[model samples]
Target chain A: MYSYSEFDEAFVRERVSQFRAQVERRIDGSLTEDEFKPLRLMNGLYLQLHAYMLRVAIPYGTLAPHQMRQLAMIAERWDKGYGHFTTRQNIQFNWPKLKDVPDILDALADVEMHAIQTSGNTIRNVTADHFAGAAADEIADPRPVAELLRQWSTDHPEFQFLPRKFKIAITGSPNDRAVTKAHDIGLRMVRNEAGEEGFEVIVGGGLGRTPMIGKVIREFLPREDLLPYVEAIVSVWNLLGRRDNKFKARIKITVHEHGIEEIRRLVEDRFTEIRPGFSGVDQEVLAGLEAAFARPSLPERSLGGFESAYTNDPVFRAWSDTNVAEHAVPGYGIVTISLKAHGKTPGDASADQMRLMADLAEELGHSEIRISHEQNVILPHVHKSDLPRVHAALKEAGLGTANVGLASDIIACPGMDYCALATARSIPIAQEIAERVDELKIEHEVGHLKIKISGCINACGHHHVGHIGILGLDRAGVENYQITLGGDGTESASIGERAGPGFSADQIVPAIERLILAYLDLRESDSETFIQSYRRLGPAPFKAALYPETAEKERADAA
Target chain B: MSRKFTPKVVTGNALIEGDAVWLTEDDRWTREMSEAELIEDEAHAQMRLLFGQSQPSVVVGVYLADAKAGLNGPEPTHFREDFRTRGPSNYPHGKQATA
Candidate 1:
């Protein structure tokens, strides 16, 4: 994990003090709600239905055990003894009072964590592959670059007030676990013909009302030019991106309206103008940041023991089959801590669980944890020797869910529950669906499914990219959920197609069950996943299953 | 019937557990008493005294329906019983008390 330097410490301390003063002024009536709202939002504090919600950034989803423990303390001391981990890989406390937020922030600063860019239109939390350093297929670890981008974009004067929130994601591997393609800027580390590591830059990807996959603006951007190139792209978007309508304010809409070619041209032009200005100082700064991210030394161990352990322990084998990933280093595995328990809220982690993860990280794995863009926690560099102990601790804490990349591990936003803009309750829906799927134990049979739920059209849940996406909407004051199928969140990312008319909140789970059964029937072979079958048969069969009566009615009407 | 609004309190584990209260007349935090009790309560004096130091602290009471009514409603749901019970339609609110 990247430890904070003196400068980083000073910056957070200063921010906390500043926010404390602001809170005092707001309470004294010196600042109006209108004036204080932006300030509070900048600090990741949101006024929700009953109380205030504070979202803390776990930058690029990385956390130290100490930081995780600090978070647990915050939840225990100031929140509901539980924290909601969000789709962005951030943790949110739903009940912090206005007076207590500054204190909470100070506590976070003590652990080298702060909520500076967690909210606001300014570049939000920089997300990356949860399995970054450990993934066997990684070309290069993306964290160093993510860290560099975080520092550069944090309070950057030019990007302080963009038309809308900007999100950036990076991936070290071709597998795309980070959902990089659905962000404003997606950077995938790639190797050139000369074997020089660089980035394959994709731009304009987003998933609000108008979902889009990023277009490749640059095929191969040299590592040195990363920051300048990013600056150029953002500057171009800021200059030309729509501001007249909030709906069309994102860079994705800008790319759509102007076309990728024009946007690429503009970015290239801007890049040419800015590249000269980035002096050797930038390179020095990046190198300094890179040094901070140097991988922790691993003690060599035998793989023979790990193989034997897996064979001997069925539980361990089951866990390894689903939750563990191949590591770049021998005898090491990337372990994911699934937050999606059967009937529990999708990403809600109790205070005790947080502390347990922190303790486990420090004891068994490296004292580091990474939050996945999928809303799960990761112990990126766990040794095979520590697997059983880690799994045992995780199981005790209710974090040992062996359903990674399966149907039960659904990504959801805190829809109608906490968000002022949600149409229906997303977390509960996600919970119900996950629980239902778990009961069926057909997740493996369903295969690699990505189910996402957004409360509304904003698509914060990335519902648009789910293999089976559910968008919760309000229909005539009733909670209604609209289902979409054939969506994917991988290298070949595609937006889902709406199956039929929406289902009532109660009808949604049963409707999903029907859809899954339909997939099984339509599948060419047992090996064919939901996405594969859906792709092969197209949306017609699924649509027919979803609205058999409607289809029949339409046919009769046509006849 | 109009939309049902859900009443909620803002207190979390950060505050004293029982301090959670429903918003009453003039932004006062009142215990979850009935409408009749709310009308006749003398505790308002003490609450006013306590909350006076905090500006913009008045917790205005509205019907549940008023509070749950969303963006496109006749008026934004504010302290409406109907709205409180039903929750906001377009966005997530009212499903959980904290939200």
Candidate 2:
């Protein structure tokens, strides 16, 4: 992890002080509600349905043990002893009072973290692959570039108030774990013909009401040109994006109205205008940034215990199979502690769990933790020898659920439960579905399925990219859930297609069950995942399963 | 012929606690929706909303939401408003925890 420079420390401290004063002014009536809202939002504070929610950015989803402890302390002291990790690799404290929020911000600054640009139309927290530095298949650690982008975009006056909130994700690995194709701007690190690593820049991708896979505007951009080039893209959008209707304001909409070719031309023109101003200073910063992220070579450790545990314990074997991934370093593994334990709220970690993770990270793993966009915590560089012990600790803390990419690993937004913008409840639906799936005992058999549920069309849960997506809607004051199938959020990104009429909340879980059960029969083999089978067989079979009665009625009517 | 207007209540989140609160007929905020003052008339509902909005220090995002006068008090007509009354459903947190 990069230590904060004196300049960075001073900058964050100043922001905390400024926000403290702003809160005081708002309380004293010097600032009206209208005036205060944006100020609070800019500081990552939102007046949610039930309370003031403060979103704290975990830059590129990386956290030091000390930072994790601070987060736990904040959760215990100011919040409800829990924090909800969101899809954007951010943690949201749901019950921070307005007066206490400043203190929270100051505490965050103590650990070189701040909520700046976590909200508002500014370039939000620049997320990267959670397995960035540790992934076995990574071409290069993308966090240095992500960090460079974060430093460049933080309080950037020129792009602060865009037409709508902008999100950018970068993935160094070819596997695309960061869901790059679903962000406003997606940067996939790639090598050119010359064999120098650069970026394949994709723009116009978003997952709100209008879900889109970003189009590749640039085939390969030199690593040095990233900042200025991205600046140009946003600048083009800043000028052309609609400000009239909030719904039509995102850069994705602008890119949709104008073809990607035209947008690329405009961005290129803008890039040329600003290219001279950079003059290679960014390269200097990136060099320093890269050095900060360089991991010391780890001595190979014995994996005797790891092998013994995997063979000896069925529980450990199941967990290792699902929760652990290959690490770049030999004898090391990347562990994803499932936050989606059956019947628990997805993405939520208790304060005690946070402290436990911190302790484990310090003792066993490197003093590092990561929040995955899938709403799970990742100890990105854990030694394989320590796997059983870590698993035991996690089991004790109610964090061990051997269902990482399986059916129970669902992504659900804080729908009507806590989100003021939500039209219906999403959490309970997610909980019910997970419980149902666990009861059926087919989670492992389902194999590599991503079920995502969103409370509304806002698509906060990234429902558009799920293998099986569920969208909660308010139909004449009743909760209705619509299903979409074959949506994927990987290298082969595709938006799921809706399967006919929506089901009532009561009918949703059963509908999903029907779909999954149908996939089992439809798939060529057990190895063929739900997504592969869906692509091969199309949505017809799944749709038929979801609406069996309706299909039968239609067939009978036709007859 | 004019369509009959559904009942409504002036609702907003508390300024400090941020919990959902509804306006009473006597110009007070109550966390319980059951104690909320139900206004059948659109003009009265607008007036109540204005009154709720005026207290910027007390509440935020004041608006009129569809409701019906139950046997005890004002009941939410929409599922969203109902959720606002009873915190998140995933766990016993927020208002549900306290209530």
Candidate 3:
């Protein structure tokens, strides 16, 4: 984990102080709502459905144990005893008084965390693969580059107010764990023909009302040219991005309207202008950042009770199969602590749960903790020998679900339940789906399915990328849900196409059950996953399952 | 043909606590929609909205919410307004805890 320098520390302190003054001004009626709105948004405050929500950035989803403890403390004291981890790898406190927010920010600054740039039309937090350094398949850690971008984008005067909120994601692995393709700028660290590490820069990819898979503008941008090149892309976007319409203000929209070729030309031109100004200063900074991310050392140990535990304990075996991933180190394993326990709200962690995770991370694993985009916590380097104990601890804390990539591990945003922008409720729907699947006891049997739900068209839950995507909408003041099939959020990413019409909230869970059951029947083999089966057979069967009567009528009409 | 305007209430979040509050006929903030002043007329609704907006120290994001006259006082017509009156569905926090 990267520690904040004196400059970084001072910067955060200054921002907190500034926000404190702004809050005072707003309270005293010196600043109007218009004046205070952008100020509050810049500091990651939002006037949500029930209260003012504060979104605090966990930079690149990485946090030290001490920092995690501070977050727990904040949740206990300031929030309603819990915090929500968002798909963007940030924690959202749904209820925070406007008066207490400044003090809350002061608390955050103490732990080198702040709400700055987590919202509004600014460069949001730079996210990376949760398994960045620890994944066995990774070429290199993407954190150093992510950290560099974080440092660069923070209070960058030139790009403070873009046409729309911009997001960037980077992944170090060939298999994209981070949803890099669904970002305004996606950086995949790739080794060139000469074995020199570089980024395959993908641009204009976003998910909202309009979804687009990012196009690779630069197949291999040298390590040195990264800062300037990225700056160039954003610069081009800032200039040409639509300002007349808020809906079409994203870089994706700009890329779409102007075409990638024209955008590339503009970016290359801007790159030429900005390249000389950097003059290796960023490279020098990156060298220090790379040095700061020290690899954890693990002593050689015997397999010991691991094999025995796997064989003897069925519960432990089930958990280990789903929750554990292969670590870069031989004896080490990456453990994903499921927040999606059966019938609970997705991404919500109680203060006690947060503290428990913090304690476990410090004691068993390294003091490092990562918040994944999938709304789960990652213990990136836990020893395989310690698996049983860790599993036991998680189970005791109600954190053990053994459903990492299963049908029940659903990703849902705080829709109408807490979000002012939400047209319909997402949390309850997600809970219903998970509980229904768990009740049926077919989650593991279904296997490797992603069910992402968004309350509105914003796609905050990355519903566009879910294999079974459910989008909740308000039709004539009633809740309606539309399902999309065959969406993926990996190296082979595809936007899910909608199955015609929609179901009521009451009808949604059963509809999903029917779809999954239909998938089981249509699949060529048990080994074939839901997405694989859908790809093999196409959306015809799934669409038929969603609306059997319509399909039957259409069949009869055809006959 | 244009649709007729529905019954409404002046609603906003409290400036300090940030909890959802409705503007009452007595010119006060109330957590319950039942206590809210139901403005059936468009002009009266606008006036109440203006009144709510004026008190920057009292409330924020002041706007008219769709509502209806009930046996009690005023009731929310939309699910969103009803949600605001109570709280989030997942947890018994916010207004739901105290109410």
DockQ of each: 0.11, 0.84, 0.84
DockQ category of candidate 3: high
Question: Interface RMSD, all models, one decimal each?
Answer: 7.3, 0.9, 0.9
Worst 10 residues of 3 chain B by lDDT: B90-99
Clashes of 2: 0
lDDT of each: 0.80, 0.92, 0.92
Better of 1 and 3 by TM-score: 3
Against the true structure, candidate 3 reaches a TM-score of 0.99
lDDT of 2 by residue, A102-186 (tens): 9999999999999999988899999999998999999999999999999899889899889999999999999999999989999
What does candidate 1 score on TM? 0.88
lDDT string for model 1 (A326-392, tens) is: 8888888889899998867778888999999998889877787888878888888888988888888
Model 3, span A322-427: residue lDDT tens: 9999999999899999999999999999999999999999998988789999999999989898889889999999998999999989999999999999999999
DockQ of 2: 0.84
Say which prediction, candidate 1 or candidate 2, comes out ahead on lDDT. 2
Q: Model 2 chain A, poorest ten-residue lDDT window?
A: A292-301
lDDT of model 1 at position A538: 87
